[model samples]
Target chain A: MTENSLQVSSIEFSYGRTRALNGVSLNVEAGRFVALVGANGAGKTTLFSIVTGLYAAHAGDVSIMGHNLRAETLKALGKMGVVFQRTTLDMDLTILQNLRYAAELHGLSRKDARERISEGMKLNSLSDLGKRKVAGLSGGQRRRVELCRALLHKPALLLLDEPTVGLDMSSRAGFVEHVRSLCKQYNTGVLWATHLMDEVNHDDDIYVMARGEIIAQGRVSDLLAAHSVDNVTDLYNLITEDNKNVVESGA
Target chain B: MSWLAALRCLRGVITREGLRFINQRGRFFSALVRPLVWLFIFAAGFRSVLGVSIIPPYETYVLYSEYITPGLLGMIMLFNGMQSSLSMVYDREMGSMRVLLTSPLPRWFLLFSKLLAGVVVAVIQVYVFLLVAWFWDIRPPVMGYILVVPALVLGGLMLGSLGLLLSSLVKQLENFAGVMNFVIFPMFFASSALYPLWRMLESSVVLWWICTLNPFTYVVELVRFALYGRIHWLALVVVVVCGVLFLGAAVIGYDPLRGFLARKDGGPRAG
Candidate 1:
């Protein structure tokens, strides 16, 4: 509604009888980095899936850059890139080949794809490992390669689903920094899904989801302040605690 | 929509499949071995027991192994196609399929590209097996050798589409072995894969009708007819019809909404 980078209005999804996303709605402005923090099964991945055209939402609408997701999936997807929660890289392929494959899927020429891949690798500090098989790369390095692959086609909106799931402290910090730098440098709207509180910067917009709903949404510091919490972890705990209590009390 | 884009996607799919095949050396060897075992040991045992009838497609008396080579080729494609689809189900379970399915390319094209990639691999394996057949002095006509490429491609697509159809319907990898045992083997055997249709007719009219009805039989017959320097229109029609039907079923099976395969419980919820 805001002509923002992305808009999800009243989306509902279910896995059989279990409702995964219930009336979920959110908006992300152009070039803004929005952190979606939630507990496991809190519908963050479900939301990401809908936005990326991986799954269709049953009860609402999603738009990317003014294109309706249902009506113009390819057009919307052309303007977006997603790094799934799992490693999608061909483990047998070299990092270069994987990136090239992604680029080709997006319709780039081989020579052009090669150049863009190199640029992407350089952006992610993975230029040195282009020729290495993904199977041999460290978890963090594989994550970076996945990120590089997502960015190969210069997508306007980049959706990363738990990009730092299994990384060490240093690697997580390094990866987050690279992500922030990419968003800033390229003016790419980013919706980063993560359960880790430490990854949410104070200035960034935050959406705290629990029980298939967004319970809190604002700048990280503002939401934390409004909730009278010291940090994201405490705020998350408070929201999830309230959810659990509601469930127990049948409210 | 552009041809260039489609071509690029096609290349990507083929390269990915090729890389996967190269990485799994043991699988390649085993795929080769399954067909060879039938060609050498099983065929040798049955060669004397089975009397040869002069079928229209056969110019002279052919050994059991020679007669079944095309069928074995179909089996190789059949198995390999299923293997590729099995990997796709694994990819879905492991979350890799989400990446491919979410790409900007149309889902149907993406799926067809994957099928084509399987076809390419199946054709390669068939050629390798043919070379070995040649070494054993089992040669189809030279022109038939060339004709086998397109025949193999059609057969590969038909089998590969069945694989995709299975992948879409079967959510878990564990269920696939059951499919192989119940569906694949029965389909292969019930058809004329091991013997000629006339041979089947002598045994039972019902069995002959079943073989005629079975699409796999047509694929095998098509390959067999081509191998012997003859063209079978009925077989070709059946193969083409089955291929299109299976591929259509696969597409419907994978539809985002209203597809039983797309329905799943638990795991990371996508939308």
Candidate 2:
């Protein structure tokens, strides 16, 4: 049986009075790339935090590789790799040291870690920068290092949270292409969370979130068709119009 | 997870902390200089003013520097513990801690490894201070140096565990100043580190009781005895119990469901 690499069901989370995630749910199956598109305050990060076990959900079930996150946290987390919204690399350490730390954290043997780091560095065209401190790397190089780190463990599921926020257009395009290639090459499941409209391709599966709920989900083309719109921006404006009104009125 | 996996994780954390300690020259110098100031300048001022009677660890009358060596070592561990907590909060803010927390290990094991790594670094600093005190003629028996390693580890564990717990309580770097003032200063001053229980009793009964109640007092006493090739059984038991409690509390404090990370509005603290 083919199991979803990630399955988040009816997850709810709150910060005292503010409900950040309200009955949110989604899934990413093996070998498929799924985009979780949302506005700035659409609860994408909150949901990701819960799924990654940063914060326990007030209510919900999250399973990874058919393993329940709460009951089998280590097994669930073992099958995944995550690139958080911010740069998590230690600026003080050299690129090689940072990656080695991640590799060791994932429990790869010395031989395996060395082989995989070499391959990942080569794959990201970061071979020459291994000895350089992460603080000296450009934004694009840092992001590449992060991607290499995330893939070092060969995770079955990869989660990226707004990874290309500050990159230039060409760098963003290159990063996206590289991630897509990695997904197809390894048959890895991907949940790419972003607020940018340009990142979602016409044929890719997408989930549109607003105000802590998934308002629409399907292939990009299908979502446009279902909403009787011709483009992503129009589709977003049409679906989130009510949410905007509610937020405006509440404010 | 398997034993090899855990060992790899432990090695990784320790290496990272060790590398950080090596790279931070200011930190290294300060860790040495802080205790040396007390040993050289402060102890010299107090040598004849406040003499130490024949303590168990010392067969005859010991000079002020000799009496305060174990206390200075304990102070090193205390400051090192507080530094670790400050960095934990800073790491939480910067998002590096997110990567560590999400690693595929038991949370308890990950936390314990972090504690052990920090204590190991502090132990090295303790030894360096011992080397400095050697020049000051505060030398103990040769075996005393070898045996003091275990005592330092035990004392470091207790202090480091407390640091881990404090990281969860004071979430912001700005608030850490208060922690140093409140936790470090009070613990350092009210403990047996600076003076003996007898001295405190001579000063005031209430002050003596406060020193006796302080867990850091037991840590100092434990290190003091171990450095002389002896064991203070009472101090040993107290340190062990306090270590377990602090580690347990720190484990819970970092817990996603039940601890400080459970339901916060602004999220984790900033550096």
Candidate 3:
């Protein structure tokens, strides 16, 4: 068995002549949380798409819990959960219905689905809002509902693409803490992609992406030290700015 | 996924579609209204001009409403098919499609389940239209109604599969209205929905050929015959074959590799 819950190796993807992902590779071990920080159009969403099986990579492999994505797609997907950049909940449905549907899509029986949904709602502080329509929920509430939906099946790896965008400061902090606790409690691997520097912590593994490439990856402290910087913000600036200069000067 | 699991997913998808249809009351009213207006108003006005020959299940000359009732039934499925496609475009744009595609089941099972769900909704609309037509005194034989079930299912699947194929090709919701004009109108007009193929042949042989070539024409004919307690074998074969072909293409269009959605984004590109 592989230690990595999610492994993306040398994956390349292109849209016409515009390369969306250029030999990008990363891994998340079981029970570890990795933060992926990148600017807009930095291929974070593109990489997420490939890992979620929404798009095929031009080259290389993605494995979820030791199942190769392309060769054993069903098995691989069965072990993964995803929270897309945009909210995907059906606004017309109640929170309960949304979670129930997600459970069924993952092939859970009704009896099992009911139990899991109730447990998920309870865990996410969404127990009272089960009957309420998702459209009526606050942004933070809806995001929490999405998290519950993704976690209902007890996926081995949870991939979130900027899950906290449009959230308030307090809600963002709440979300970060909740996700951290969930990861520890469930022993689940998580790859959280975002552009916000504050979302990442000192001890977390940080992968900085730019121009479809993983330019730097390490603990925040190590990254900062390697760049001769004192903090995460400075390290981010140095790497992205340095990559841009190299590209611009070469072009 | 296990067969039972696949069945569960199908149940969920179908239930969601049913709930969506029920929630949108306006859509229900409109889906029924269009066919009713055509049956009550258009058929009445055109009855005098369009004379009918003694077609099977009719020993005597029939009313235009009766003649076109089956065609109108086909029309319901046609419009619903396109509406389902429009919903697909909307789903894709709103990001819900990603959630659906990421399900752990086989991709083909997921796509087929979605198509089946749409067909179920269209069939419900079709039955409602038939009931209203019966209330309007455009009644078929009681046995014809019973036999029409299989025909409606087949026709619904055929048209719904075509919608699936169209949805895979159409990228944006804003561009779908143009597709309605180009695909829906041409399909509805070029088929035997409003007029008999003989009438089309009398007007122009070219149109008659086009009508003959259109898959919609076969579905319309299949429904027409089934509603009269008869079977049109050729049309049945044509509709089934077309359904299979369209469904196959749609599954390919949704394939993770080389699929329309997975291919180039933003604009069209040459191979």
Alpha-carbon interface RMSD for all candidates, in angstroms: 2.2, 3.3, 4.6
Q: How many Å off is the CA of A223 in candidate 2?
A: 0.9
Ranking by TM-score: 2, 3, 1
Q: What's the DockQ of model 1?
A: 0.64
Candidate 2, residue B92: Cα displacement in angstroms equals: 0.6
Candidate DockQ scores, in order: 0.64, 0.59, 0.55
Q: Which ten-residue region of model 3 chain B has the weakest summed lDDT?
A: B262-271
Q: What TM-score does chain A of model 3 get?
A: 0.97
Q: Residue by residue across A17-94, what tens digits does model 1's lDDT show?
A: 888888988888877899998888788988887777766788899988888989988888888888888788878789
TM-score of each: 0.96, 0.97, 0.97
Residue B254 of model 2: what lDDT?
91
Give RMSD (Å) of candidate 1 vs. truth: 1.9
TM-scores of chain A across the candidates, in order, are 0.95, 0.95, 0.97
- Residue-wise lDDT of candidate 3 within A1-251, one digit each (tens)? 53899999999998878888889999999998899999888889888888998888999999999999999999999999998888999999999988888988988999999999989989999989999998899999999999999998999999999999899999999999999999999999999998988888888898999888999898887887777878778889999898899989999
Residue-wise lDDT of candidate 2 within A1-251, one digit each (tens)? 66699999999888888778888888898988899988888888888888899889989899999999999999999998998888999999999999999999999999999999999999999999999999999889999999999999899999999999889999999999899999999999999998877887887888888878887788888878887878887877777896678779989
